[model samples]
Each structure stands twice: as structure tokens, then as C-alpha cells.
Target chain A: MAVEKFLVEASHIMMFARSVGDANQIYYDADYAKTTEPGTIIAPPTFAQSSAQFDPDYFLRPKIGEPWFGSGKEPTGIKRESSGGGGGGGGGLHAEQHFEYHRHLHPGDVLSATVKPGKTWEKESKRAGKLVFSESITEYRDQHGELVITARGVGVRTERPVDSK
Target chain B: MALKASNLRVGDTHSVCIVEDLKRTQIVQYAGSSGDYNPLHTDEIFTVKVAGYPSVFAHGMLTMGMTGRMLTDYVGDGRLTKYGVRFTNQVWPGDTLQATTTVEEVADGIVKLKVETTNQNGVSVLSGYAEARVD
Candidate 1:
């Protein structure tokens, strides 16, 4: 598969700041950020993860090949048994998130992000049954070709009937 | 200039910082500004019907920002060496986030700390660790 590259614009930064209810003068007010410790209104560390502007269908859309799969949802890529059989339901659960910041990303700082598959494997679960674990890492770079941020996240997925009760 | 490994112990914990209760409007404004239209975070009905959430919730990044505030307070300017975190759970409006830090290991002027944020119910909303260097 070809790697998809995306550009994160300044407006996105403002929007992320708004979504998080971050009223910090640094993020919204340029003057404040310039005077602040980071020396610029820098993006909140987790802001990049919340952008949600990626092509969700490609990597995140659930049950790509399953007929009974629902819309707006994607399989967590986690399966129960080593033979790929089921144990308990619920496709996947959030496992962990890790972020590293090199420099403060400010307004008007265009960021280019390239996401790639990091790892995939299976694990035995005591309660939720067997699980599939997938991880992806997205690296963001500024227009100046400087590293801005790096994020690695894991999603635990399983094959189970949708919960109705 | 170097933070010795003995500087931080496993049991060393910092004072807790209590964030003021954020309003629904603040969350909504964030939705409009950030472009993260995940209904689970901005729309009450969508949250209940689709995501099974109680109500509109704050963005995870918002909670992370609060953690950043804690760092700024501790290290001051030009002193922060390295910072990182992992998002563990969701944070809803009206939820108060309390952040606490504990020294884990300090070696060669670098301080490693475990950081966490929890809600009033004592449920951990975000759990992760961080490392910083002091000048």
C-alpha cells in the first residue's frame, strides 16, 4: 500500500484548540505565546492525535470485508483465538497512546504527517477472550523540515458479536 | 548540572493540581474551533445513541493540555527537557481533572516522572509517564 501524506494547516490548529476548551492565551493569542515560556503559542501536545482529518475509511473503517459489519465503525484488528475464532465480543478497545514533542508547533506552522503501520500481533485475554493488537505511528514535521511531534498508539481489537443487551 | 539517579525515588509524589470545572459551551467552542466533530464529544444525542456516552465530553487533547500546564508550573521556562504522555480514558464536561506527578528515576540531570489524571470518582482518566531535564 502507498503511504498517504497529509498536511495539517493553521486553521486546524485553531480548531483543535477550540475543541479542547483550551483558553490558554498562548494557543489563541499570539502575543501571549510569544511571551510565554515556549516562546510561541504552541499546540497542545495531544492536539495532533485529535485532528480526525485522515481518510478514516482506508485504515480505520471497520469490518472492511465482513458483510454484517456496520458503517462508521471499523474492526479493531484484534481477534480472540489464535485460530482466529471468537471468545468474547466487542471488536476492540483502546490500549495505549504515546507522544513525543521536539518543538512547539505554532499557528501558521504547516505540519506534514506520514502514518505507517508499526506492529501487529495477537494476545490471550482472560476476560475479553483472545485479542488482536495493532499499532500505528504518525510523525509530524514542520515546514522547515524540523521534527515537530511523534505519536504511537495501540488499539486492541477482537472478533465478537455486537453487544445488544 | 546532572540530575543524579538518587534524586528521584519511586514514592515521591507532587502536590495535586485541581482544574476548574469546564462548561459545556467551552467544549462546544472547542469543537467548532478544532474541527474534531466526533459527535461523542460535541453532540449529546449522538454520544448517547452512537457512542453510549452519558453526555458531550471534553476532547482528550484538552485534558492533555492541562497536563502541560502542570509541567510548565514545575520546571519553569528553558528548563523542560523532555515530555510525553499516553491517553487512557475519556473526560466529560463538568468533570474535574486532578493531575499528580511522582518522581520515578533521575539520572544525569534527567528526571523521570509518572503522571496521571483522575476524575472525582477516583477513576483514572489519563495515565502515562514523562521525563524531563533540569538546567
Candidate 2:
């Protein structure tokens, strides 16, 4: 996903930290952060993935007038084109993710992300059937045009929903 | 508070109970913050009737994110240079997770770490590696 502007703010970082159950004061309390090495509230290691919030066309999020895939009145807001695949209904699942941080993120940092398709491959698995994996690489650049983080993500569509063991 | 290369060893390991009794609400919180509102992670009806899962599950990134906390808490804030993970199994509600990091190497002011997170059932949910700067 290409995000022209991902605004990093303190409150969002705080909530992101809380979601992962991280209670480190350095993520929320600026005063306490001053006593730390970074000298300010810094985003968590995986916080770069939150750039989805700034991507206006991210499909996972429902738009104002669009038909979403999630449940509503009829167990789903949209009609299923086909229900032949395994568990996630071929909705795709996160397979792997890697991040290279040139620098940590902090409040007031405005970043932009550019995505480049990486590779596509297929694999067979006992628990999930045929797995189709595709990768994408995103480069996050700060307002000053310095590359901040390099992220590689792999998404897979299984032949069937993976068996929860 | 960064890790000192002088005190690190190849076999040194640190582990933390990342989450206890994982809750659906926390999953929702992650979806809201990360903007990954995939139905399989939040909507139980869609997940069960449509997606064909037993119930909603946690996002893989959520597990990675939580596991990341264990790394930062051990290596200290803003010290990470690289962190990555592969989702091995789905994380579900009520599953307590433990994340562990083992020092694989220390050299030239950098420490390489092997990371893994497992559910209470002793099944690995995520596994990967990380590298960080050291004193």
C-alpha cells in the first residue's frame, strides 16, 4: 500500500502499544520518556504496519458507501462470489513479515510509504492445502525524505481455511 | 538501557509472558489501531459462517507486535535495527502467549536474536529473528 502521508502522533502510538498489551511508559508518557534513551515517546517495532490507517484505499477497512465483507444483517455485508476455498475463504492471511528500521518513529514524524511487489510462489501444506504466497516490499520515508523503515510482507491464500490445531 | 555487547553471550535468552488469557477486545483494539479490520480477526459470524473458522482469531501482526514488546523490553527502547517473524499458527482467544528471545550472536556493536512465541498449548504461534544495536 502506498501512503502519501502517515502521521505519527503520540495518542495513536499509545493505543497501538495498548493493543499489543505493551505498558511501557515510554510509549505513552512523554515525561517518563525523557528519562529513557530515545528521549521521547517512540513507536513500537511493528508500528510501521499501521501505515494502513493512512492508505485511503486499504480494502480491509469498510468505506462509507461500500459493501464490506464482514458480517452485518445476514452474517456478511456482501455476497460471497464463491465459497470453495479453505477457512479464510481465500481472503488471504499474513504469512510472514520483516522490518528493517533505519530509525525509530516518534510523534510529529510524517512518513510516506511506497510499495513494490516482490515475489509470488506456491507451496503445499498438510494443514492448509495449496498455499499461494505473494510478497510486497514497502519503503517508509520520513518527511525529510530519509528512508525510515523497510518492510517486507507475505500474504497467502490457502486452498481451504487452515485447520486450527 | 541498551544491551551491552560485553555482557551478552550467544546462548543468552530472555522470555516474557506477552499476554495472559488473550481477549477478543484486545484483538479489536489492534484492528482499530492497525487498520487491519479483516473479518477473520474480529467478526465472529463472518469468521464462522462465512470464513469457516471456529471463531475469530488474533491477527498475526498482533502476535508479532506483542512479541516485539518482549524484544524491546529486553534490548531497551529504540535499539532495534531489524525485527521479523513468520506466523506459524493462529492465535485464539483465551490463549496465553509466551515470547522468547535468544542471543544468537554478538559482534561489532550488534546483537542478533532468535525470537519465538508460543501459546499455552506449547504450539508455536510465531517465530523469527531480530538484530539490535548494543553498547
Candidate 3:
């Protein structure tokens, strides 16, 4: 797991919400949100985790040579070193997500996230046989050094991705 | 209506969010905003030909976030203690999604909910739950 920090802002919060096609005004309208108990715009659930792009070293960063969603039919030419046996290469898919809110997040909250490895399990799957799953938990705290939210996500990796064709 | 923990009861239902229809560009927008460059969600050529899927699909997070609108809308900002989702199916373009929640438990000023989001076809795409302290 990788640890990185970020300063949450109203604009970023609004963008993430809008990007998801969310119509909640509290996420975008500070004036409207001010009328609410929170008194300021707040991020929607999993906003910090979904905004991992702001943190470069995020644990869930796509592997260097792994297959990306937008790539061609050809396999990525990147090679994983043979030194690793148990841990496979960089290709994996997001399997599940969890978020625990310790407190509300508002604009101007300087959040720092520490991504840690969580539970690992193996199961037989009809789609991908003997699938391996790993969890990554990212904890976000505010500027006052208080926990705001803990985001737990799962990634499933297959030795070779399934062929839909 | 904001639901207080005291008011929670099993079978209490909350109508949350309705994604009238999904748009391909919306998925692209989400990927751009979230900084996820996964082509499987947006690259039709890559997804259909390279990945062997019938078509590109929505990002799981995109669906999760949309489903989360139910909790956030009901409880408002910062009231939710925990929320999570399990991806169950592919959400394709032209699909309509509705997120709904049911009160499963209530005690100690904490409310537990059984959350579900399904497409127009009545097929569940995401399922999970949440816990929030009601005031």
C-alpha cells in the first residue's frame, strides 16, 4: 500500500460528483449546502477513493505494463520480471469497494490517505478459475489530523484475463 | 426526508436515486474526473475486440457512486458511517438504474440498511449495505 495526501476542494468535489452524473446539489452548490447542517459542500461517498488520480503513488495505480481499459486488442508488451512467483504482474480488476465515514468531508479539508493491504482470499469462479482477490484500504484524514473516511477496495487478478470472444 | 436513527424500522424503504439513462460519455466523464484511465469502460474497440466483450461497460465505481446517491440523499452530507457495494453485473449503455434502500436494523442510535441498485431489467448490478448514526 502507498500513502499520499491531498487537499480537498469544492471544485474537485463538484467535478467528481458531476463526472459520475450525480445531481445532488449539496455536492456542487455551496450556497445550498450552507443551508444544511454541514454548512458547506461535502463529497459524495467514495469520492476520495475515486479521486486517487490526485495521488500519483496510489496503491491502485494501474501496473506499468498491465492491460488498460482503452488499449488495443494486442496484449500489452510490458513484461513482469521472473523474480516474483507468488505475486503476479500488474493486471487486475476492481472487485469490490467499502467506505466508512468517521466524519463529514467538506471543501478545504486537507486529507491524507495511507493505502494498506487488507484481507486476501482465493475462490473458484466460473468466469476466471482460481481467482485471487486482495483488498486495499485507503484512510483519509483531515488537516486537524482526524480521520474522515476509510476507503477499502478489492482487486481481483487472474493469471490471464478472460476472453469474452 | 432525512431519516433519523430513532425512526428506522425493518422494511422501511427509502427511494433514493434514479439514473434515467446511462450515457457512454458519462462513463468517459467519470473516468476523466476520477483519474481512472481504464479503457475497458470507454474504449469500444479495445473492449469489444481485444477483451472479447459484446460492448464497453460502465465503471463499477460509476455505478457505485450513483447507487450511493441514495444514502447521501437520505442522510445528507457526513451522516453516513459506512457504505459499500459489490459489483454483480455489467451495466451497459441505455440501461436505467434505480437505487433503493431498506432499514434492516436499528438500535443504539445506529441504523443499518440493506442497499440495492438494479437496472431496468430487474437484474441486480450492485448490492451492499450501510450503517449510519441517526440523530
Instruction: Give the residue spans of candidate 1 off by over 4 A.
Output: A1-24, A50-94, A122-131, A158-165, B1-12, B15-24, B51-58, B77-89
Residue pairs of candidate 2 with colliding backbone atoms: A86-A160, A86-A161, A87-A160, A87-A161
Residue-level error in angstroms, candidate 1, position B5:
11
**Candidate 3: tens digits of C-alpha lDDT, residues B1-135:** 456766667899887546877889998888877877666677776556555566777878898888887777776566789998888776888889988899889888788889898888888889999987777
Which pairs clash in model 3? A69-B38, A69-B39, A69-B40, A70-B39
Which structure is stronger by lDDT: 1 or 3?
3
Expressed as tens digits, the lDDT of each residue in A1-165 for candidate 2 is: 689999999999999999998999999999999999999999999999999999998989889988888888888888787755567543589999999999999999999999999999999999989988999999999999999999999999888888988
Off by over 4 Å in 3: A1-3, A58-69, A72-90, A159-165
Model 3 residue A127 CA deviation (Å) reads 2.8
Candidates' lDDT values, in order? 0.59, 0.93, 0.74
Q: Using DockQ as the measure, name the better of candidate 1 and candidate 2.
A: 2
Model 2, A54: alpha-carbon shift in Å? 0.6
Stretches of candidate 2 off by over 4 Å are: A83-85
Interface RMSD of each: 6.4, 1.1, 4.0
lDDT of 1 by residue, B26-117 (tens): 76665555444444455565345434445666766566666756664554433444555555556767777788888877667777777888
Best by the TM-score measure: 2
Ranking 1 against 3 by TM-score, winner: 3
